[model samples]
Target: MKTIAGILFIVLGILTAYQSKQAQPAAIDYAKERVQILQLIDTESKAFWDKDYEKWASCWAQEPYIRTMGWWKAGGVTVVKGWEERGPRTKQHMEQHPKPNPQNVRRENINIRILQDAAWVTFDQYGKDNGEPVMDMPGLSRETRFLEKHKGKWKIVYVGWLLEGEGN
Candidate 1:
């Protein structure tokens, strides 16, 4: 009788554990996360076109903590571990290369994916840079960005771009 009671208690514990696991919520809802990330992208794009650095900076994770990387076809890759290091450099560069014709900018074939607290997006971008159509210069380029949810916001942590076509 004692052995049978012990076995029953063990089985009950196992069943309870399984039931609790089943009741736990999923870590991510892809659809919801996708929408949030898309909104973030739109806001960031608008900020860039408007030359709103403060708003643009808000879309990125705070630096000195987040691992970050920026890549360009010409420069290859620049690894900046913290936002503290990247933010000022980015601001200075943009200040020098003002976006005179942001309306002509285009982002095509945008795709986004979310995995838990992380997300990534890829797209083909082409536009006027330095007052000339990029298509006339470097042409269309592919861009990929990695983002993470921080402080209830999705912030970009890494961005990479590759100039399309050969000899670029």
Candidate 2:
């Protein structure tokens, strides 16, 4: 009787452990998530360059804490905080500069790290126009983007970049 009871206790312990493990969340599909993130980033850039304000706004979070900042040799530093401020300013800029400034930019040395609902991405970007390097804009820039997954979609929360050289 003692032997049977000891074996049953061990079996019960194993079953309990197995049940607990099964209840844990499944692993994240990082490859799929990375693709989704890259798509969103590309969409945002396209919308901006196309001067499509509505599409551009869709890529960003409408939260108050959202921000966009950049630093360049000519412009020094610029920080735009809050979606309310950023959104309106962007719309106005697009309206003022309605011409589509199409970009043939190459992004390289990209790195992305995802942590549950948040992600951080960094890349070096080179701009080109008419089969030649862009002269009026920064030729290369180091860019960083912060995104958050909300309601099963990723949205940009922060963007910061540093241009490699002065603007023309």
The numbered model that scores best in TM-score is 2
- In every candidate, how many clashes are there? 1, 0
| True-structure RMSD, every candidate | 5.0, 5.3
lDDT for position 111 in model 2: 100
The true-versus-predicted C-alpha distance at residue 89 of model 2, in Å, is 0.6
Question: For model 2, what is the error of residue 52's alpha carbon versus the real structure, in angstroms, after optimal superposition?
Answer: 0.5
* TM-score of each candidate structure, all chains considered together: 0.67, 0.79
lDDT of 1 by residue, 125-157 (tens): 774444332212144767788898887678987
Clashing pairs in 1: 63-83
